[model samples]
Target: MRLGNVSLPVLASAVLCLGALISPAHAVPSQPWYLAAFDHVMRVLVNNEAPAVQMASGSAEQQNNVDPAYYSRVTKEAGTITLRGNVPSDGDLKVLQGVAAAIAPGASVVDRTRINPGVPNRDVWLAAMTFALRQMGKLNTGSASLRNAAITIEGVTNADDDFAVIQKKVREEAPKGLNLQVALKPHDVRPFVWLAQLQQGAVHLSGHVPSEQDKVIFGHAQVLFQNLTINSSMEVAKGEPKGWIEATKVSLEMLSLLYSGSVAISDKVVKIDGIYSSPAMVDLLKVYSKRLPEGFTLETSILEPVARAPAARAEDMSFAAHQARASYNP
Candidate 1:
């Protein structure tokens, strides 16, 4: 049977049987374990001291007003790091904290209001932020799990805005399950990335800035995939010239068999070939035309997935299947 564009090989009977054998207990505080696994997966995908190096070319384009370089030393560095298994240490925490501070330096909490009284709203906001940061590669997931396991931020001031207040409340209620409603209105100068992974072990990623102009110029930019069988669709929403670029309507397609190791991803690689056009793209180009180097223009296309050795064990699969079970059972 096929779901979306990918095929499924497992029999319904066997799948149900395996499902039954796996108790909800298998779904307990595996957050730490999942974090470790996710960190390993990212290590394999983006190996380097600074995984954000890929942005250098774009940075140069924005600064020097030149045609952005398509590749960088960081890309090769990531390749080397992924091969060496030199995962970042807890010291990376300081590095990420510095990044967070840099992203929102001088930006105050402003105000805080309670959205959910039953749960620790502050903690939930923080958790969501942490999830966002981890998704952006600013924070090492493994390191975050370790730090958050015991540490708690207290007495943080609340914000006036809904998102800010929500984030503040979530942060205040830390070290607990996040069950709160909060909103976040990060100021300008925030750096981030959009990441999408599938149950079949495929991953799709892109980088963007908060500004609308930046999003228009870079949002419809290059997309990188880790495996091919899965298909992903991403939408880019550019905020004000200096606000956040949001990705919505993101989806992926893949065969369930890949998660069970019954089908090898390398053998079933599929290609996505298409073109995307948007008024935003044209407007962004016009706004940045003078800033761009001669012969430079905004374009969008699918990038070839980086090749890596397959996981050696079932535990190494990307979080799709595990997360799916957790989402349904949790």
Candidate 2:
């Protein structure tokens, strides 16, 4: 009969048996044929079919041979939610489907996940899965992913309230064992631009500030540049990036340390240029930049050293003194 499907363990055992009969001590070549055959087969199996072959071996130890983790992903778009990846058991798969259904009511829920019993932490994995679904459910169109122990949730939405819900979930409800990443952006596809310049004890703020954050940002500027006029030309608007407020606050803190400089924020990038007096200011900027929230980039160029006037020579000082005495006597 023709071979339909061959289990990796069975195939390995057959190879080992054949090797036993082939008596490697009597072989002429330096490398025995059976060892070579076994190695090649193992390499192919491990690379290509480790998961399925290991599961099919029907041994508890063999089932745990591969990675002791599960991969689960969920995506929501166009009124449909799709689930794909691996779960520990059929019960867990049903639980995931139930979560998807509960999160997106009236939306179609599709399950395409498999049951893999090698999951390391079932409770933590399920918590992560549910967290992802809840985050995605708040977005107009979004995707949530769980790979091993990392969970990523990304979405685009028009309402700030919806974004707030996602932020709240991440802050208060994230699972203990999994790493969570948020990449939520506004549905409005417009570039966000913010500019601030400090000159002669006055700071001019312009460009886009979130509607809800205008007062706080302006007040923060006033506090950072104490006793300086806060001239705001910024217009309140939406579509700011996830870390817009935090990044803006950090940028303003950096600008406050400058003698005369300007900071510009374009989309997710903050560009700072100006002059500073002390090297300590640069070190402080480096320290504050680290506090800028994730997903934002900082670029700085500040002038330094505070150009000094030249010293007068001794002869010139004596000549000036003599001239002053002559004028006074006259």
Candidate 3:
């Protein structure tokens, strides 16, 4: 065909046409499927409160069941994602399923790490945890009512074997009389002789029982611990924690909004204002506190509901069906 002043040579045209007919079509570019799948998995894990997600430093393995079309490539390792709270085995399995469904639907564990079986001296362990939790800002320091309070340890188990191993390891690592017990125990079953819950917040503290031996050992050592107590709390005048959404709008991001407000700390309530963010959005704030005497262990599992953005709604999926129909049509 001739257009303007240029004409296509018959031989060249024929060769071009033949090449188009014989060569395979290029594949469509897809968003990194594994990233989306992993993101979803992480969201579920975080929502369910996992302590950690251990991955190889740079493994490129992707869960099989997630839709490969949403991501371009998967990282070999997602890194270890630690959950702030304890995750039940059943809950963990559900998260695994959620990840599988996003990538390879039928994929099963290729390899796995067995749960560690060990128990530490409950009294000693609780004391250590109490000390650590207090340092982490989870427990409150003042409040006479909280003193001598009874606390129930939930979510985590105190295994016999684990305790034995810890004791053995401590003895082996430290000189004799160095592994001192710091946790206070009552004559009764309760391990804490002096523990108090915040009347209005998530913070709790064990009564201070000065041990001369513990003072001697810890006086000059540099040790760190995880603090898992609620630092403050806030009241919701309009929005609630359940209203948090994964969007930019203030209405959609209620948690972030609430966190920006003032935190009121008192005997009746301790309000904490803080930010919560993920890869998709930024500057999320939330107000949370634990209800205790109701439960213990410092880490309160506040059940909050989440909202979805209208733009991200799954109902707006008709275009995908139309595209599939057009592609499949004869």
Candidate 3 vs. true structure, TM-score? 0.13
Q: Which residue ranges in model 1 land beyond 4 Å of their true spot?
A: 1-184, 190-200, 204-330
Tell me each candidate's TM-score.
0.17, 0.43, 0.13
Give the distance in Å from residue 268's predicted Cα in candidate 3 to where it truly belongs: 1.4
List candidate 3 segments past 4 Å from native.
1-180, 185-255, 270-330
Q: What ranges in model 2 sit over 4 Å off?
A: 1-69, 158-165, 189-330
Candidate 3's residue-wise lDDT over 1-330, tens digit each? 432454535434554565456424432235333334444554544465333333332234333322322111011112111112212234443453344333433333222312211211223323332322222121111100001112221111121123223333433432232233322211111221222122222332222222222232122111110222333111111111221110111211232222111212122222232222242323233222222222222221122223655343223223432332243211
Q: What's model 1's lDDT at 86?
A: 14
| Candidate 1 local lDDT, 13-63, one digit each (tens) | 444465557667764455433444445444544465244643552454344
lDDT of 2 at 167: 62
In model 2, which residue pairs have backbone atoms overlapping below 3 Å? none
Task: Name the better of 1 and 3 by TM-score.
Answer: 1
Best by lDDT: 2
